[model samples]
Target: MPDNKTGPFLQGITRLLTDGTLGTTDIVESMHHRIVHPPLLPSTPIQHLITGIAGITYRNIKWSTRLIGKGIDKSLYKLAPFLGEIKDTPKKVALVSILNGILGDYLEINNNPLAIQMNLKNQDRDTSIDASSQACELRNVKGRILIMVHGSCGNDFQWNQEDHNHGIALAEKFDKTALFLNYNSGCHVSSNGKDLNKLLERLIYIWPVPVEEITIISHSMGGLVTRSAYHYGRLNDNGWIKHCSKMVFLGTPHHGAPLERIGNYLDTILHVIPYTTPISKLGKIRSAGITDLRYGHVVEEDWKDRDRFELSGDQRNIVPLPDGVECFAIAGITGKTSDKPSIRKSGDKMVSLNSALGIHKDPEKSLEFKKKNTWISEETTHSELLSNKYVFNKLASWMK
Candidate 1:
């Protein structure tokens, strides 16, 4: 039998409730322990049981908060004109707090869950691909292999949409094969990148036929993963670079997203509360999602011109880039200003025009690719940039 923490935990809770041994501090301490020491088997039966119990607790708190937010949103939407009529800090704070609550709810609930699981399959099946002689049957007959890496909180299905998922479109356009690289966004950047590089090395070596080319189109944090994978591939002399012919970045924060810093502030404040541990995990700067957005943890001297943010390796170009690879970037500009309307003007609320297009050389600027190699679209949001019609065409054009 498994060493069951949940079994004991549940029994303890029952006993505490019956004997009145459980106090708020005791409950809080138990929860804190569980949160800090996440189970090794997230999906194990015991873990699932514990998670279900926790989920119920979460629902109670979340529902109350959500209802309050709904009420506040209704009030705010109705009080649009009243903002000018009343000049009070308390009101302003209340309105701001309401807006924040609503935004948080929308972000959490509106995300595409189908896209989250599109590439997830039996991990065992993936590992066994190497053992089978027929592992790469599709690649052997195909002329090229297209690997797709998705952005933050995105999945392969995000690329499956006819309008936005570029990898599927490219496969049909080129009659080539494709593979979706799926990974958790919560780990460390270098760790995930190294794993991707290793996977790529295995795929290429087992490929049954000559791979004419290997092309990648990455969005947001995916771009950073691409770079990190390339860096590790070269650093380890993994030879995965030999298969890569082209790469494209869409709305990638080559430097870093200012909003993330803002999020860090918000997360810091939220973390002080005992109820916010799950939400707080999303903002750790060292998380793979965050690190990729910031590139590396440390900035390198050489990258100072291209990327202004200081990551651990931001100043060092120590990571070797793929040889003879074509790199292109497409930036988004919703509008010109930082005002709400500016989001409509140049950037995808999350990323700005200058940052998207690699226009500013101050922080590290993007490499100057040939006109045919680069694509810029200011009309799309960061999320929408990946599937823009013109952007897809540009990616296809480059491959040709």
Candidate 2:
């Protein structure tokens, strides 16, 4: 039998090799087409020969890796019975979290073990926060619950940065139950949102005591997922929605992240150049989830039947903050003490100030957040927002 510990590693490597080989083939073929077809650039006979050879080599590698991958998969299956008993280490979980952020939808479709499943976890113990196991799972149940949602390529445990966990600290100070959500960051925001809605319903029903309030604190893409859940919960009339009292978005790209927009721009530019058009496909290789960030998509209608990486304008259906729930947004800037307008505009090096604060040129599309509800933190990067003292103080003030 294959070593259960090594099975996941081998399987993951095999999948990567297989996907890489196939991607290389596609890129080569695209290049070949562009070189030989309409709007083709002038090429010498030597260039034609080199392209031909490259295509053949790509195909050879594709077939070779696929065969090897199949063999590795077979070995993994033989050891599958024992795989269930093996617990994933923190490092493994972290790696999978990154993979999920990159190719999560593909992993799910392929039923890859690397795919992360959404679950509420007990931060004190490495266990699922199950309603049936509330007695042991939740040692202290409070009327007010605080849920922490991590960003793309993140897990619940990683919420603790710089030796401080905002969730735990806030929960302790406020006497609220703190739960962290672990989920595949690569899946569409709406998909995770719907799942979250159902999970909350179960949580509310099985709480040890009557639940009084629910407050969600989400960072980065996690914030989008929270909004999506709220939208769906309202539509389904889920009881959990009624208990939701507040939501705090830390560096959330309410309008969308600027980096994704830049990526989309590069992809469009590459496609326009015939010589480099094949390389453009690499830009499209990002998962549906990443592409969704281009417009902070929060519903199935926003992406269903559409090519996620297509060069198009913001097609996202504007999803305003849920009614009756107090919403707060935090924007972070990298500079320590810069008065330059550019420094403030370049928010957190990932999201823009306008997007994070839900400021839009169009009034109808802009989210109506009260001035007091929004914050801007200078000398803080996007990730630093997770543990910054100033941000923490603001969160505590809002919760209070």
TM accuracy, model 1: 0.58
Off by over 4 Å in 1: 1-134, 137-140, 162-164, 267-288, 291-323, 336-346, 359-372
Please write out the lDDT profile of model 2 over residues 1-400, one tens digit for every residue: 4455556655765787677778777787777767665473577787778777877876787788788888878888677657754466667678878888988888888877677778888767466754333443466689899999998888986788889999999999999989999888888999999988888888898788899999999999999999999999999999999999999999998888878989998998998886888898888768878988998888999999997777788877888889999999999988754568877888899999888999988888899999999999988989999889999999999999
Question: What TM value does model 2 have?
Answer: 0.89
Best by TM-score: 2
- lDDT by residue for model 1 (149-186), tens: 77665555556554345776677788777677665544
Q: Considering every candidate listed, which one attains the maximal lDDT? A: 2
| Candidate 2 segments exceeding 4 Å error | 1-10, 29-58, 80-89, 130-136, 336-338
True lDDT of residue 60, candidate 1: 67
Worst 10 residues of 2 by lDDT: 129-138
Query: On a 0 to 100 scale, what is the lDDT of residue 157 in model 2?
Result: 67
lDDT of each: 0.55, 0.85
Residue 172, candidate 2: C-alpha displacement in angstroms: 0.9
